[model samples]
Target chain A: MRIVIIDDSGLRATVLEEGLRDAGYDDIHIVPPRGAFVARLERMAPDVVLMDLGSPSRDTLEEMLMVSRALARPIAMFVDHSDDAMIGAAIDAGVSAYVVDGLRKERVKPVLELAVRRFNAFAKMQTELDEARTALSERKIIDRAKSILMNQRSLSEQDAYALLRSSAMNQGKKIVDVAQALITASDLLGGGL
Target chain B: MSLRIAFLPLTDAAVLAVARERGFAEEEGLSLDLIRSTSWATLRDRLVYGQVHAAQMLAPLAVAVTLGLSQQPAALAAPYKLGVNGNMLVMASDFAAALDPDTGRRLSDPLGTAHDFAAAIGLWRRKPVIGVVHRFSSHSLMLRYWLASAGIDPDRDVVLRVLPPSLTVEAMRAGEIDGFIAGEPWGSAAVEEGLAETVAIGERIWQRGVEKVLAFRTPWLEENPDIVDRLLRALIRSASWCDDPANHDALAQLLSDPRYVDQPADLIARAMSGQIVVRQGEAPIASPDFLLFSREATPFPWRSQALWIYSQFVRWNMVEHGPEALAKAGAVFRPDIFRRALADADVPMPGANMKVEGALGLPLAVGSRKGGLTLGPDRFFDGRVFDPERMEDYLTNFVSPL
Candidate 1:
């Protein structure tokens, strides 16, 4: 997996880079503290992002938050010290792992693995949520279309749904799509039968 | 109560460090955990999110947070001021050479130096990029106030870069920025390495300018009033110790720990004693009132000071002026809470919640709870007095860039 390390300190970046290298991860990129850091990360599109900030000012945190929001990769941030509020903000900004006052060479591999795992887990959950939301919205649209058909044709709810399913099967389309088209046809015809 | 507090690695964090190190917290039935953060943003977030019970925050930052400028809008409160007037503006040595030759005179006269800075800006090859600790920092506000007095528009004339104070010296070394304004000993660190020279001290811009504060989330503070009171009492005791000349060495040593400031004792001691070395190999200047920790009601959180910060925000067009926002900003500095915490202490408490900021030309007696409260000079270098009561008039008086 490709790794990108964002650190303002040259010395600490070297330490983290060396640790990552020893763990047999060679596709590592170190970003300096100048000129569109997030843009550079986007171009690199690393699998995981590691940031070691000696002291992160508000500006830096905001910039990092922008990157976290943009990228789907796992991100692990290491700081010399952190407050509860900062940690919360970082998490809210989508950081996978936040290690405080624990910048050691041996700790890097474990943290990286854990961060990637957590990120994958979070991504899976998010995908599930999105799928569920889309299904629920589609179900609502299908129900609305069924009710419209029933009102126009004087049919039962079950008959309206059966007609929708049969139309979808004959056209090789989703029930929601057929329902949507029927609703559109009725609306365009000024709601008459 | 067990309290975890966040602080930056600066000399101004001495009171918090000493409070935890010298058993002051323990004496008040509190266990203090002092976490050293690298930037004001992190420390502010720590307090806002309930990660730490409190934080050593920039005076303006606390106000800005309450004003919803920093990040998420959260009501933050400052019950105690940690230190006053400890920050300074430093320019690269090459940049300094273009300004003033006499270091002592340049350090003393802000107006003269500011004019020199304006001239230097003209002669410079490019728009000089100066690093400030944070956008809402007192250092940035002071820099803008100083530069604007010389008719130098900060936004148009120069590039104000945001950087962490600890990395300022390195940024200067890399030529990423030409100068930086931050709390000691970062500025002193730059001077010590022959990289920069002190241009204007915060004290010279505004004597006893509000700097760091013991800031807490408003909800957390309201819920834990007794805990807040205990923490304030401990901090007040620690502030007194920090102010005492006898404990300067010990305080410096404690601050020099790798966990805290992590600088040499002498460098930290210079700020603690108010004897600053502006340049390498030059005689240290005796700036006796360089930093005030406890005396002169320095710990009291004046609502007027918060209004003054709000005025600067209005001046900079950072926020629109409205009575509701102004009231919220003014309420951030809880003098009532300070009075409540230190009611029985030997320390004298100010009788009123607000005062005419920068009105005191010299040490003057003021009505106090315990009597004998003598406030020191708090004159703005531009000779502008800010009456908290007349905020709209005070704001209208300024020729703000907006």
Candidate 2:
């Protein structure tokens, strides 16, 4: 039931430590990305060694390859199956995993489960942040689409949203789809579509 | 019509690049599609599995695939030698200058430059670490073969590691590696940047060594024999175009562009022109056959080159035993396929076997070079003489005149 976290991120480690503590895990330990990292890795020998997903310490991880191999410990990490396309993206993104061998597969589930949740949470946060920034641009696209609709049918703002909503209901499409379609068609026509 | 053939974008991959930019592929109803791959393993995987129809591969890589050196119990049957030469050894300047006294003369062997290099490294106070692009590559074997011939222990005396050709210059600059053997742009780039000195051009070691070749999944080549023929014809034309001095500027431009080497064209042209640029501040020496794609270098698919590669396989214990080595080299190197490709385009085929004695020789004064056993150094670590006569014949069987 004991696990140690070895990551370069202090803030991430703090949050993980707090979360695990709240989740009733008493033997959770955290180590930073410097000296004492390997000693802690060896001394703690936790059931799981949870490191930050994309820290810029791959060389450190790579340097550990020989030592890990010499010790006959094969480390594997969670390859993001939920996002298959992300495998290449992750390799590009510097996301990698290393789990020591001899750890039972079933016992490692919790480790991977936590890592996936953390990664998903991080990804979801990124998506939301991107969306927030693009909200203005998306609104302008909708405005462009709306202007075209208004010019074509003399529909007001209220009528336009209503029409779009009704169209979504009929076609089972999202409002973004209708907005995108309208914007694309209008651009192609050299003005309002 | 253009065909999108995937290729690992390296400097020595001249024929494919020339075909695309010089309109040679088009001459044979082929459009060039050169995809960049990070590793030969990925290149082989994609080419073998049909993700990509064909590619410019390590000559031995094709042989390895055909011979099953890589994925044993699963051998690939493919045809064609893609291209040759344009590889060299680049050593840290300090190491290059530190020649061992016994080497007799100042280091001067270009073809087997690494062999003399192994001598220099062996006699060094510390075992010198050598870098090559890949474990299965000829660069690795060449370095090992040269070292073994000089009576040096490849494993004990030197630390060998693979650093991708693209990263070698940077690695040399950062001092992470002592020296490296890699194809064109990487070696040339090192000299241009003053990071490493060119120790030797590959042609001087094994003479007209087989460098790169087109390899495809057996099933793919079988189904598209006409396309293969067309592709080969285009490649040959590109090789011819590359050989012409008039096309030098164009070849340089194609490789220096962001799509290919993405380095300075002049540096790449240094190798492409067969001008041996030593990494040290020495003048560039002319080795006419350095980047040969056409002329006498084109056809013949010299069996000697294939045998040289097999000699290394035996030396390294990569083939611990048996006819697997010969079969492997035979399977991937399809001179027959290359000839078929050339014939369809009406390109005249060269001789079946070539005499490379002119390029084979020894260097004056190995640079701090240690001594190596004269034969297979790894499997026969006790300094036993391997049957070179037998090995040579085994290697020449598949690709020789027949």
Candidate 3:
């Protein structure tokens, strides 16, 4: 797996790099401390990111948050210390693991593994949430279309539902998609249905 | 009570460090875990999210967080102030050359130096980029206030970059920023390394200016009043010890530990003792009262001081002025809590919760819970008085078309 290390301190970065290499991770990249960092990370496209913020300011923390939000890769952050607000922000920004005051060479592999595992678990849960939300919204749209049909055509709810299903099957689209199209047409045509 | 406190590695963190190291907390029946943070934002976050019981936080930052400028609005309370007036503004040697030639005079007279700085800005090669620790930091606000006095627009005339105080020297060395205003040892560190020269000291800008405070989430403070009281009492004793002349050397040594400021003993000593070396090869200048710990009830969390910080937020357009927000900002400084915590102690505190900020021009006797409290000069260099009661009027004095 490609790994990236983000640390402003050269000595700390070197130590982290050596530890990662010792752990048999050959593909490693170090992010430069300055310039367009997110763009650079996107181009590097590492599977895992190990960030060492020796002492981060609010601006640096915000920048790191943006990186975490943009990248889908599992990231582990090492800091001398952290506060609750920053940790909350890091978690919200999708940082998989945040290790504070335990950045020794011997501890690297397990932390990396945990970070990846946690990130994958979180990503899976996020995907499930997105799917559930999509389904719920689709059901809402389908119900709205059914009610519009029932109101305009003087049909029962079951007949309106059947009409939507038939229309979806004939058009080779999901029922929700067909319903959404019908709603859009009704609204665009001044609801003249 | 077992309390885990987060703090940045600066000299001002002495009270917390001493409390943990000197067994002050243990004496108060509390076990203390002091975590050294690198940034104010992280420390603020730590307190807000309940990762730590409390934190050594920037006074303005606490207000800003409550005002919802820095992060999600959290009602943070500062029942005690850790230290006052311990920061400095250091400019690159080349840039410093353009300012007043006489270093001693410039350092002594802030307003004259500010005028000199205004003139120097015109001759500079570029709009000088000055690094400030944080947007909501007292250093940045003071920098703005000092620069504005000479008709220099901080927003337009110069570039203010945000960098951690520890990284300030490297940024200046890399030519990324021309100068930086940060808390002690970092400024002293730059001077020691011959990377920068001290141009402005926070003590001279506004004597006894509020810097760091003991901050906690309001809910946490309210829930653990007994613990908070214990911590404050411990902190009060620690502050007195930290202020003792005999303890300065030991305090400097403690701060130099890798887990703390992690700098040379002498660099930390200079700021701690109020004898700062503005430039390399220069004798240390006596800047007494440079960093106050407990003298004159320095730990007392004055509510008016909080309003003064809010007024700056308004002056800088960081937040829109509203009575509700103003009340919230002022409420962040919990003198009531301080009074409750120190009620039994020998500590003399102001009788009133608020005072006319920047009004004191000399050491004056003030009405106190236990009289005989003499406050040091609390004057703004520009001679502007901030009446907390008349915040709108105070703000109007700084109204411009910015």
Candidate 4:
């Protein structure tokens, strides 16, 4: 079966392509975000199309359905009646599929399942990367706030840290939030270390 | 009760936003979880698969989904109309110059400009590509209706490209499309940027025409009558608030939030107040009744309006016209539920479920349960009437280009 994946992110498309390749499906095409996507897909009439649910071009595909003459065989979304859980999972994972009408469900199920699994993996990796970046920035902010406190109040580093923790607890906010507030106040008051 | 509702960011979605932000939903003991969708296709899927309790949807899309034109066949119903007559057709400057030079007159006389558009097709650089929001959208159906009247085959003489309403301006700037027909703020944005000029307004094509409706899955609506009634009541109160002239400023400011329509406040205000700037740097033209949310029973979903949409499907060969298909399509608009929800309230309702569409030449007060109910003029520009009893004659009247 021929499959085409439409996604704007190159890395996500490459990962999905690699997963499909490993599953013994050789005819795979990746169409990135570019001009005239519908025309490109028309030239390569794939049996099944995999697309990111967030892509705005999905409406373009709907237009193709209206002008049926443009397509070889009318394509419909691959929504299996017997498998509601799998379909819901695919939607939650931001994956959608459109297969040429009369294509067997048995042939399309595995391909969609593989896409869902790959998309979830990519999402988890992205979340981890974002969290790591945020944590590093918060740490730097907290260190700067502690040093300013130590210099302005003539207190030790340990005492400064305790002061920030108590202030955060009193204000019902996070330590990073309190630390950021301290840094802003110090800069505004011309007392930056 | 908490209900999740899906909607696109457009001026017509004002009712839902007002319902949630202004405490109308809370007053009825309901919490509305509004999910902003990027495309109508995704919004349909969300409502079809039980992700949302309801959605603000295109009228024909609700019918098309019931008929199973796209995706799996799922029965959907629209008990309340979100808004009416808020869409516009805009053409690029170079192509528009071929038509009437006076932009105000161009929109005022759509029939005359349509012929001019037909004559200008041969003078263009290439095939004119017009952007529509969706295949089963009201704007697309209206474009086809207006173009066919002037001997322009929408499918052959010109190209209909589908783009999201928000992306229409960018696409026009990129020269990917010559023009687009979409709901407000987007059309106003295009005109403000001097990229396009207004050719026709939907109100003139078919005055008080059906646009967006509050759609819900059939099974879900049947299972929870109490919840549905409460939500409709909330929407009724919200719609009244949106229609008031005194509230337009506050309403525009609320819609300008980044979480909603997310355009400039002044640009969004122009559509709500009906002071449209059709051309770049031109003085605003006052066209009151340009967009109506609740005035004159506007929220009522007449079944005859649904039949009008069904006829268009047959006109374009989108669906095979049959009694079974016609009944199914007409059943998509649930006026019975609308009446049931407002039975106890002081709201006045039309006594009939269906009427002859485009027959009303002027505002007429019809029989109603409560007193003081008047419907405004709803006439087609070509002076053709669509009577639900004579669907065959209406379909035969449109002479297709052989």
Total backbone collisions for each predicted model = 6, 32, 4, 0
The residue-by-residue lDDT of candidate 4 on A1-193, one tens digit each, is 9999999899899999999999999999999745687888888888998988877788887677556676779888888889889989988998999999889989999999999999999999999999999999999999999999999898899999999999999999999999999999999999987
Runs of candidate 2 with Cα error greater than 4 angstroms are A1-193, B1-4, B71-74, B100-107, B110-125, B279-282, B297-300, B351-389, B392-402
> Model 3, B154-254: lDDT tens per residue?
98899887778887888887888899999988998888889999998999999989999999999989999899999999999999999999999999999
Q: In terms of DockQ, which candidate is stronger, 3 or 4?
A: 4
Model 3 bad stretches (over 4 Å): A1-30, A35-58, A61-193, B399-402
Greater-TM-score candidate between 3 and 4: 4
Predicted complex 4: CAPRI docking category: medium
RMSD of each: 23.7, 11.6, 24.2, 1.8
| CAPRI level of candidate 3 | incorrect
- Report the CA-based lDDT of candidate 2 relative to the real structure: 0.61
Model 2 C-alpha lDDT per residue in residues B163-219, reported as the tens digit of each score: 567667766776767888888778777777777666655665555556776667776
Q: What are the candidates' interface root-mean-square deviations?
A: 4.8, 8.0, 5.0, 1.0
Report the C-alpha lDDT of model 2 over A1-193, residue by residue, as the tens digit.
Answer: 6666766656556666776677667888877755435545665555555655344233333334333433445454434345445444433332334556566656555555555556555566667888898997777767777778888889998888788778878999977678889778777888855
Candidate chain B TM-scores, in order: 0.98, 0.81, 0.98, 0.99
CAPRI quality of model 1: incorrect
Instruction: State the TM-score for model 1.
Output: 0.75
Candidate 2 reference-contact recovery = 0.00
lDDT values, one for every candidate: 0.81, 0.61, 0.81, 0.92
Output the worst ten-in-a-row residue range by lDDT, candidate 3 chain A: A93-102
Ranking by DockQ: 4, 1, 3, 2
True contacts kept of each: 0.47, 0.00, 0.42, 0.67
Clashing residue pairs in candidate 3, if any?
A83-B46, A84-B45, A84-B46, A85-B45
TM-scores vs. true structure, each candidate:
0.75, 0.64, 0.75, 0.96
In model 2, how large is the Cα lDDT of residue B69? 53
